[model samples]
Target: MHDTERMNSGEIRAGIGLALVFAFRMLGMFMVLPVLATYGMDLADATPALIGLAIGAYGLTQAVLQIPFGMLSDRIGRRPVIYAGLLVFAAGSALAAGADSIWGVIAGRVLQGAGAISAAVMALLSDLTREQHRTKAMAMIGMSIGLSFAVAMVVGPLLTRAFGLSGLFWVTAGMALLGIVLVVALVPKGTGALQHRESVVAGQAIRSTLRNGDLLRLDFGILALHAILMASFVALPLALVERGGLPREEHWWVYLTALLVGFFGMVPFIIYAEKKRRMKRVLGAAVAVLLFCELFFWQFGNSLTMLVIGAVIFFTAFNLLEASLPSLVSKVAPAGGKGTAMGVYATTQFLGAALGGILGGWLYQQGGLGGVFVGCALLCALWLVIAVTMREPPYVTSLRLPLSPTALRDAGLIQRLLAAPGVADAMVVAEEAALYIKVDTQKLDRTSLERLIESAPAMC
Candidate 1:
């Protein structure tokens, strides 16, 4: 039958290249988050509201076009879509860099966001890797994103100080060009459109995913998390400059220290949730902490010490919630619907970013820092109420095991497979000739499962 070897050289190369590509693009977006609110005032016609809109403008286009771009990739090819996206991103960076007015920057940001290739990129990653090693490949991409965020937090201010905003945009443009070269030179071409049940969204699954309460809840969680994040950044940088008496150049220290504290504080809870299967508890607690951080900042933001404390708490919850929401979505999605579920989840996330940017700007204009924090507090409180009712996610992992077309039609065989030790749920996709199984690895018998799969006839 099938080769079940571990990840080989090609898979590793593709994973690393794609991860870098994603990181470069994200870095361009994130590098503005920490300094934009304060430095943006220097632009012509800049206001608190327009600054927020410019900060989040990319996400708006990204949300609207991701799925359509994914569909285009299916028709044309992944590399073409990816190349076009990078080019658009680079052009947008250049436009924003040269802009003299906030409106020009907004246009550039909108163009930058118009390069929506996340779905295409993820699909290409699925094509380049085997199902067994896909999770590890995706993990690499996720790690790259986290690394980009950390680097951007530190580098945003540094770049602003050293090169100015124009320089930062020029650098981002260069990075996007570099990403294009990496794709052209290093990334392997996909064979064709492969139906990766875990990665490619099926149109039919959308309705089902929407109907899933648990998955919907996870969707809302991601939306709220990103919303709070964007909204916070709108006010946070200005607060640091005005209330904490920190210069724009010195802002990185607060971010660096807070990120470190938050990272360290968040690990134990993540481990506990995974090890003990107490995700609801950890998730709820993180939400509560988010609420507390918002209120704490609203009341004591004038003091540097209190501001630092609030940031640490804010990021701790942010990191934890960000990591956990995707895992819960995977767990809650019905078998064969993981890709659709994630597509919806990602859409909600980008929508939140767009909403957050606009709302943060409007609120800041209306009530300054106090208004922004109060709005975020309410968002967190609502999430907390939602989190309290979420069911504890089961301890299970997805496996795409080989299945012949004939066996896929055998309901009796699927029933028997589900009855097997450690097997929690199983659904066979006949078109793909694979069984998407959710199982507890702790009690699974790999040898027996392999034998059963191998024993099936190749044809009807």
Candidate 2:
């Protein structure tokens, strides 16, 4: 591989540092998911509905603020935005730790979501890495999130068991502090925020991204996926304790088992989806799996063995969809509209979490675990229908290349790029002096594109 294709040590360091930042932040957010339902009831004035609100309150703020934070980074700088967000998160954690009531926990969760720094963090990662290696750097962040979630499921229960919910909140606050240290001491500074169309949302592109039918379907899909996940968790922990005969401390074993089995089970399907170019088919199948799991849980949740089976199946589908959805968004996104589409996608995802938490709590109060399961089943069914009807996504990856002034003026540049093997779409932004193209990497003729750039005529 060319040196350009490989990430240098600086890039590697940046990627690792940023990934840890993401992990720490996400871990703080996720560690409460499993414990809150069972333990949160002890808080004064706790109700199922209020407990659910507390669980998902952060998502509401996160959804609302993520885009603005990204834009803010462009103005004030990435590190400053990150530092401020993390501090806000720490403050929220402290508030929750000291609160004796469910309402206070909800307030804390909202504050936690206020630390909407994901976009800023991603923007910084883009600044620190080269275009060719950008995908790999982003992938590192994605993998860190997955790993943190898995760890959170196990650790949340253990921490809550040992130190209670207050202690858990305190720990999350400490983790947020640790994240600040990582940012200050380890993460390399970027030169400045660059308008990376592929990575940063453009305000003008929002309407167009929202209007895209395929992208909208994907947005709905993520919303539904997370909605189902949040709703299921609202009842799942209690079900495990009440019906599955599992003790609180042993809950980690269930998550650990389910995550392990589900992760391993999801690998081959992911391979099939990517290698066989069967993304739509696999995605629909996963939704169908989710629907089946919900129905299964509704019917057989009273039994320990059956609940475990349902969880394993649910996680298998959940992990697959989680891994696949972002890839689909990337593939379906317009040449220069990826950032906007993803911004919308992310917003919808958080909205789903908020809706799910509230809906799940209400349902749990109305009809207990069965109602929650039934509600999720309906959501899965709707997502499955949407998945089946969506258009097959083009299997292409976006690439951004700096354009020389001569090349920018070349009228035939786009046609030439589209003519290259595997090239599907091309756009040149004169203002930015950049060319954004989508290419099927498996068949892309890189040398031809390089030659065209190398041999471009000079201006008269």
Candidate 3:
């Protein structure tokens, strides 16, 4: 492989370091998801609804502040924002660790969500990586989050069983501190922040991004997916212990088994979707699977065998949808608008989590586990409808290349760029001296693009 196509040592270090930082923070947040409903009742004045609120409170603040934090990093620099966010996260964890009531845990969780550093981290990663390697860097962060959630699922129950909820919070706080250390000691400091529109949200693009019908569909899809996930967990732990006849202490194995099965099971489907260009069909099928899982749970929840089977099926669908949504967002987002579209998608996802927590708790309070499963089934049904209706997404990848001053001045730059092999769309931003394009990678002739850039002035 050419040097441009491969990540160098510096890029590798930055990608790994940033991914670890992201994982630590996400692990802290996710560690409470599994154990909170079961262990939280011991807190003073705890109710099912309140427990659900505590489970999802972080998402509320995260949804509200994520975009602003990304914009803030553009002003004050990435590391400073990251440092502040991590400190706040650690403080929230510490506060939760000492809380004696559900309300206190909710407060701590809200504060935890306030840390919101995802955009800043992505921006920093963009600054540290070359354009050719930026997607890989971003993928590393995505994979880390998935791995952390899986780890948290298994670890949360074990920690709660051993040290109770307070100890788990303390551990979460320690993880935040470790993330701070990684940021300081390992993550490479960029010379300065660059405005990589492909990776960082632009303020002016928000309105148009919102107006996009296709992007809105994707945003709604993520919202429904996470909402279902949070709401399911709201009742799943209880179902496992109360209905499945499993001991609370052994809950980790159940999650461990289901998640392992789910992860491996989704791999081939993901390959098929991407390789065969069958994203729409696969997405709809996954949503339909989720609906089936919920119905199965609702009908046969009392049987341990049925619960395990439903869980395996649910996770498989959940993992597949979770993996697919962001890729769809990337494919469907308009040229130069990917970052903003993603911002909206992420915000909607968090809001869904918050809504799911509240909705699950209320349903569980009113009608028990049956109601929770029914509610999720309804959500899946709606999502499946939306998925099936979505237009086929363009099979293309985003690319950013530095434009020479002469190239920026050339009147026909876009026309010539578009005429290049595999270039589906191209835009040149004079202010940034950058060229952003959507290209079909399979057909993209990099050598042709390079030669075009070399003779851009002559082409005009």
Candidate 4:
């Protein structure tokens, strides 16, 4: 039976299954953020620069490995790919847990990134659902990511308080193992294998992804967002310990407060944007808020309360942009190249993480918090300018069309599709009868799309 025919609870649960699996993977990385630098100064004879390298090594490796893992999932099957990744991640966590030196931890971080399963999970999600409900499925994954990030901020410091960073690693290992169970027992298996070779070629896929002035803007947006995020953390603990007069033991309260405020702050805006189709407007407002916050942080971080306020605004905009960018990618990417586009996007995302860590550390070391915030302010300004240039993303839902014999046999179908007013692009895989089309919301005519498919000549 198709996923739509299943009970709503089951469908939602399936989405949850994917989300939790993703969260398990992400938490391993995020758990170290809040407390590591402060405490890590002593462990493995680390300085801020080495700590930053340890923190970012995962992204460096993840950027390199994510696409290959996803492609492997298409061929070997999602379940196996995920299981292997999980085991590998667990092994890395175990190594980090027992590390005697900074190099050992860095090596472990690299191993952790090597276990890239994000693409596989996404591909599995695509297989488990009908095309119409794919957005909903994807939304679940996105929400989980945000939620996990928020949850980790509050929980990470507390975990450190309870058991130290090594304990965090052990816990991360346990979570990865739990994911193995979820994949094997809960996630349904089908076309989510690792053999989708066409998904990897970076030709039209890379060109389309790169040339889109808007997508590049968002790419810059995320790179800027993550850069600020990493930079802030680099400065935050030192600020809290040295400036805010907070002990390392109590830092979670600040994180807990900022995260709660930020998550709540972004939600209404997300709802408004989606319901009213004001994505561009909402996004613009959010970016402006972000840039101002960076400036605010630069001016006001000397005061503890002002720093808290700045943190809230920074994260508020961070959450909003994180949620919005993927939506825009879905709206803008060529339907035939979504996977490829995402592959490239993922690479950029991880590259951002790595760059953020490296640069953020350098800035913090050279000029203290002021320098870091100045860098963040500059990035936010660039993102603001870039985002301001984007056309509003369409609110129309995407539909994945499976190929039929008739649709394939028609030599002129691609031409007919190009002629359709609302159709942006179409890719018809004759053998698979899988058709991918993007509809322009301004000119959307659903009946025309349906009728064209119904009337097409023999394809098979």
Q: Using lDDT, give the best candidate's number.
A: 2
Against the true structure, candidate 3 reaches a TM-score of 0.97
Cα deviation of 151, candidate 4, in Å: 1.0
Q: Candidate 2's residue-wise lDDT over 1-460, tens digit each?
A: 3425678888898899999999999999899998899999999999999988888888999999999999999899999999999999999999999999999999999999999999999999999998878889999999999999999999999999999999999999999989999988888877778888898999999999989999999999999988888888899999999999988778998999999999999999999999999999999999999999999999988988999999999999999999999999999998998888888999999999898988888899999999999999999988888889899899998888888888988887888777777888888888889988888878865555667765776668
Local accuracy by lDDT, each model: 0.88, 0.91, 0.89, 0.77
> Which pairs clash inside model 3?
none
Weakest 10 consecutive residues, lDDT, candidate 1? Answer: 451-460
Off by over 4 Å in 2: 1-5
Candidate 4 lDDT tens digits, 1-460: 2434543555566688989999888888888888777877768668677777777778898989888787676667777888899999999999988887877777888899889999888877766766556677877888788778877887888887898888888899999999889877777656434222123433446766788777777777776777677777777887888777888889888888888888899899999998888999998898889889978877877777887888788888888888888777777776676667667777888888878777777887788778877887888788788888899885654556765676677788888887978787777765456677788656866566867877777544
Q: TM-score: which is higher, 1 or 2? A: 2
Instruction: Per model, state how many residue pairs clash.
Output: 0, 0, 0, 18
Best by TM-score: 2
On the 0 to 100 scale, the lDDT of residue 332 in model 2 is: 95
TM-scores of the candidates are: 0.96, 0.98, 0.97, 0.91
Instruction: Judge candidate 4 at residue 308 and give its lDDT.
Output: 85
| TM-score for predicted model 4 compared with the true structure | 0.91
User: Candidate 4: deviation at residue 211, Å?
Assistant: 3.3
For model 4 the local lDDT of residue 303 reads 71
